[model samples]
Target: MEPPEIRFQILYYLYNKYYGGQTGKLHSAEKIIQETELKNIDRNLINGDIAYLYSSDLVTGKRSIGNGGYPPSIIITNKGIDLVENIINEIIVNILNQQDNRIVKNKIELIAKSDQRTRITKIWGYVKEKPELFVNIGEKALKLFLSGGY
Candidate 1:
């Protein structure tokens, strides 16, 4: 299996490719194989990478039927979309140094590196005082955070 970073890369790739994680869009395994940076990676490894993303709830797809098989379709979940958008937003914040965007890009980088559970825990701790931050954590948690929906 590839490293956790590879899973993230695959997740980000699918998010961008599939209209920023719009639900219900499905693509063949071949398209993913031929188009992404992971193209050169062994098919089995890519399968594993996708599996990792699936387990993390960053993607939704069928499991490969047998050992070392590729899943038939791939779709980035809303959670995955939120992750990528959050990172992008954080970068924009860093570049503009705007007063409203309180988070620095470095924190976003760290959040990107961490798993979903860990990211939520850290963010929760950081903003525990602000009860509004908890509103979207149920359905579109990360999205609310990035959009300042709270």
Candidate 2:
């Protein structure tokens, strides 16, 4: 199975392409490749990603490959939204797992660099003692990170 994070990214991209704007929103395969900041990615690989999500019933799209075919256009399904939510929940669960996850550590480092109260040593010990605080911080950190503030 593709990892949940990768799946979430693909679903998020399609979801945003279909619904992120106030005006008309649609993206072709070429558009997805051209517009996304995802680096070193190949068109064929992304097409395969589309196929995988489509097969999982998480997205709706038509993928055509060959000489005289239209480009792929995809939209997220309701199931995709649910799966994305579940994936985010899983991310929180994983962070709350208290293992040494690199992403959470990195995010904590970012926080430490941003504010003294959120310094890694302080927040780490506090969060270890109080899981609830970690959840609140995690939610905020996740939002900030995804919003490109980190």
Candidate 3:
């Protein structure tokens, strides 16, 4: 189950990254609010989310050494990479097994069943374009199927 607080935090983090995090810059709360469309910015909620991320070692914060301090800049850590990898792997596995085929398939039916069809199609298309990626995915799928854990 997804927690509302976590969901909000994830959205906020993505919003910040979309705006300027990619450039190694921090966005202000107002900017985050504007981008995320969350009404009545709740400091408590934001703080809670930050705390959770911090606890998970997914982000870190520091005070800026300037006249007017800016909001803490967040960076994804190795833990964050692991988290994203796990999520992506789970999503790929789920979409591939939609028909309970016990293996990954290149059928549109299974891809369409995914909530993010466009993303799934794009990812699978990319995988198809790259023989190495396809081989890796196929190996992983075969391992899972042979293990009888699907």
Candidate 4:
């Protein structure tokens, strides 16, 4: 069976991108949802994810006055980063062991040919419009993945 998706992944990605190694940085839920490209993630799911993260001592949220009027901004802790790293490592190892190199290559090609390409293209447009926000997020994510023991 496929392992459940860890919400910490999205949290860590945000933390790493915006917090610059700090434990807590105020980020609105709407911003997080948009930045993470969490397609169709509802309010209930977001609330549940935040609750789980908070319970695990991975993230903390606070009320903030922003464009969204009362959005809670969340910050990630060191524990969250560690959790995300572990999950990513596990995924990389599993992928490396279970799939042949050719299969992996083909899958990447297929992804490039299919929906991911369009999605990435759209993200690129946003990035171009707001270069400062997405500056190193993609590069950092790629670097992290490549440095793993895949």
Candidate 5:
């Protein structure tokens, strides 16, 4: 298995797109990078993760090779879907069973209130339209929150 945080992010992105009417449609590798915003994680690392996920039969897809392949993409297998759901359910149960889980429960509720796909899509669109704007806005928002604007 991959590192918990990295694995969770990858699975979450796949699950979101899979449920967002994409079905078996392939998602470009570039799109995956953009969606996950894995700046701190090397692209090669994600590629390795993808390869490992594939070897474990959790996912199946294609990769861009040289210049002939043109574009790259990936698609989750049914196994991946099942595994992700199970992992998510287990995580929820674990959190709920934790002592003094009130704060974690609240955070979960906050996340559940939003449509993840829409939020991700908007952010991805912004990145493509103006990456500098996206970075600046995120920094500004975080700064504002730190300054007690939340």
Candidate 6:
């Protein structure tokens, strides 16, 4: 079985894709798997992960009864959205503290103040336009933050 953290990542990814402007949206399991690039993972495993989130009140969805295609749709709860946003804020603050460059720090601060949706978009824009700005953050940390992990 995958670690619990991996399962939790599903919740985070859902928040990034569907929260904020798209709040309360219900998306197909197939669409979610494709977006997160978890297509190779078994449908049952995804169902188990969704079940875990559901049990935690972080999500609402139907899990396929067997190991076949994942049925129905999924929605992230407000609680789940808050959880992901809080983690992101913590990560941004940590990155800002570690950064000595004033310019980089300011940029990160701006991104942090924005809504979750805007933050992700801004971060990616920065990454693509000014890769050098995030050199001090370390690749692993940056990747984690970008991939919906703290």
- The top-ranked prediction according to TM-score is 6
- How many clashes does each candidate structure show, in the order listed? 1, 0, 0, 0, 0, 0
lDDT of each: 0.56, 0.52, 0.46, 0.50, 0.55, 0.64
At residue 63, give the lDDT of candidate 4. 44
Ranking by lDDT: 6, 1, 5, 2, 4, 3
> Lowest summed-lDDT stretch of 10 residues in model 5?
141-150
Q: What are the TM-scores, per candidate, against the unseen true structure?
A: 0.50, 0.52, 0.45, 0.54, 0.60, 0.63
lDDT of 2 by residue, 1-150 (tens): 223323445665665554445123445656665665444565555666666667767776565766133336667777766654443444444555554768666664454454322242344454547566465554543443332232
Model 2 clash pairs are none
lDDT of 4 by residue, 78-103 (tens): 77655555544443334334455575
Pairing residues by index, what is the TM-score of model 4?
0.54
Off by over 4 Å in 5: 63-71, 101-150
Q: lDDT of candidate 2 vs native?
A: 0.52
Root-mean-square deviation of every model: 12.3, 11.3, 11.3, 11.7, 11.5, 5.4
Question: Per-residue alpha-carbon lDDT of model 1 for 47-69, expressed as tens digits?
Answer: 77666556667777776667343
Q: Which residue segments of model 4 deviate by more than 4 Å? A: 1-6, 18-23, 63-71, 102-150
| Model 3: residues with Cα > 4 Å off, grouped in runs | 1-23, 37-43, 63-71, 99-150
lDDT of each residue in 1-150, candidate 3, tens digit only: 123324334433543363333644544444554555354556555555555555555554464565133234555555544443344455466556543444345653455456542443344454556545355553454344322233
lDDT of 1 at 7: 58
Name the regions of candidate 6 deviating beyond 4 angstroms: 1-9, 16-22, 42-44, 62-72, 120-150
Worst 10 residues of 1 by lDDT: 133-142
